[model samples]
Target: MNDYLVKAVAYQNQIRAYAVNSTATVAEAQRRHAAKPTATDALGRSMTAGVILGAMLKGEEKVSVKINGGGPLGTIMVDSNAKGEVRGYVSHPQTEMEINEVGKAVGMNGLLTVSKDVGLMHPFVGQIPLISGEIGEDYTSYLSKSEQTASAVGVDVLVNSDSTVKAAGGFIIQLMPGADEEVLNIIKDRMKVIAPLSSMISEGSTPEQLLEHVLGSENVTVLESMPVRFQCQCSVDRITNAIISLGSEEIQDMIETDGHAEANCHFCNEFYYFDTEHLQALKEVAL
Candidate 1:
């Protein structure tokens, strides 16, 4: 099934929840970056959480998640908007390690930073030390400490024997400010008994089913559902604009020295090549 996310409220709107099925979305990132199993899990989990966080916003708002856990995976970065579009990459996509070792591969010594751009003069940024190096726990810590919301986050990615992603998804459950202790206890109890998220995803569970599993079918009231996918905002025109901003001197230098200019987007791994003729055109525009 195509990837998608669902927003819902449970226990008479006392709890806010978001869930996503990100299998295809993560598969795209794995294919683009050629990420190994460990890197795939790290990137997939972060992207899953990032997209759900994005769904919390409105209009043109967006969020960016950055994780550097001081391990072999290096850095994992993901960007997502309220539209359910997301893109991400890992610094060392080829890092080799056993599956389900994302914590060790990601280490426990760095930080997870979230920046939200809500059309403000400056984006709001929050940073918290990594509590577990596991993407889900780190995000849970980030939400509780940075956003000051009591939240439970569960993110998982299952990798096949061939390094392809078998399933990738996650859920975020947050308690509203007026939530009662009984509601909190019930949620905590339910969380302790739910099947592993990876297993549920591998079994073809939908985002709605995932939420029902955690929040109970009777309690969850679906709010909105939207398709989500791997979507990079990079394009040749944007790259061209960046080059034009470098000034005519820089464009001329590229034409004289290299005969061509090539730029690769880190998020999508797409290359933009500008032949000498293209450089001349941009130089004129720069002038």
Candidate 2:
């Protein structure tokens, strides 16, 4: 099934929730980056959470998530917009490690930074120390401490034996203002008994069903559903503009030394090559 996310409210709007099925979305990232199992897990989890956070915004707002866990996986970065488009990469995509527990491969040190661009003069940025290198817990911590919202986050990715992604998805549940203690206790109790996130995704659970699994089908009031996917913002034109911005002298240096220039996007791994002739045109434009 194609990936999608669902937004919902339950218990009379006191609880707001977001859930996403990101299997195909993550599989594309794994294929693009040639990520090993551990690296795929880290990247997949971050992208899942990032996309859900993106849905919380409106219009052209965007969100970027950066995680540096002081582990072999290095840094994992994901960008998403309110439209449900998301793209991400891991610094060391080929790193392989054994995972005996939830946060083992991601490590327990470093920070999770979230930056939001809301068409403001400066984007709002929040940084928090990683409580657990597990992507979900780190996001939960960020929301509670940085955003000051009481939230529960669950993100998981299952990797196949051949390093392909089997399933990837997550959910975010937050208590809105005026939420009662009774409602909070019920949600906490339900979460304790819900099936593991990976198992739910592997069973072909939809985003709405995932939320229902945690929030109860009777209580959930589905709000909106939107398709989500792996979408990179990089393009040939953007790369060319970046090269031109280097100035005429730099373009001349490229032409004289290498006779050509090539650029690769870190997010999508797409290559952009400019021959010597193209470089000369860009040099004229720069001048």
Candidate 3:
């Protein structure tokens, strides 16, 4: 099935929730980055959460998530827009470890930062220390400390022996201001008994079912559902504009030294090549 996310509210609007089935979305990322099992897990989890967070925005708003744990995996970065588009990359795509060594592979020794661009003069930034190096807990911490919302985040990815993603999904449930203690206790109890997000996803649970498992079928009222995918904003036209901005001198230097210029996008790994003739044309336009 194609990837999608669900927005919901439970307990008469006291609880705000988001859930997603990110299997295909994350599979595309794994394929693009050639990520190993550990890198796949880290990147997949972050993208899942990032996309959900993006859904919380409106219009052209965007969010970027950064995870640096000082581990072998290096840094994991994810970007998502309010339209359910997400793209991400891991610094070290070949990092791998034992199945149960998520913390070690993620190394709880750095920070998690989230930046939001809401068409403001400056984007809002939130940073928090990594408490677990596991993506879910780190996100939960960020929401609580940075966003000041008490939230429960569960994100997981199942990787096959061949390093392909078997399943990827996650959920985020937040307690709004004035949330009653009774409601919080009930949600907590339900979360304790629910299966891991990856396990439920592998068992073919939809985003709705995942949230129902956490918030109860009777309590959750689905608000919106939208398709999500791996999308990047880089393109030949954008790259051409960038090269032009470098001015005629830089374009001429490229034509003289390299014969051709190759630009690779880190987000989607798309390559754009400009031959000598193309450089000359750009140089003519560069003022």
How well does candidate 1 score on lDDT at residue 17?
94
Q: What is the lDDT of residue 269 in candidate 3?
A: 90
For candidate 3, write residues 1-287 as lDDT tens digits.
88999999999999999999999999999999999988899899999999989999999999999999898888889999999999999898888886646677778899999999999999999999999888999999999999998888989999998999999999899998998867867887888887888899999899999988898888999998999999999999999999999999989889889898999999999999999999999999996
lDDT of 2: 0.92
Off by over 4 Å in 3: none
Give per-residue CA lDDT, model 1, range 148-243, as digits (tens).
998989999998879899999999999999888677678779889998888999998999999999988999999989999999999989999999
Error in Å for residue 100 of model 1: 3.3
Which 10-residue span in candidate 2 carries the lowest summed lDDT? 98-107
The total of clashing pairs for model 2 equals 0
The candidate maximizing lDDT is 1
**Full ranking by lDDT:** 1, 3, 2
What 10-residue stretch in candidate 1 is worst by lDDT? 94-103
User: 1-287 in candidate 2: lDDT tens per residue?
Assistant: 99999999998999999999999999999999999888898899999999999999999999999999787788899999999999999999988876524376677788899999999999999999988898898999999999999898999999999999989999999999978857867887988898888789999889899988898899999998999999999998898999989999999999999999998899999988999999999999999
* lDDT value for model 3: 0.92
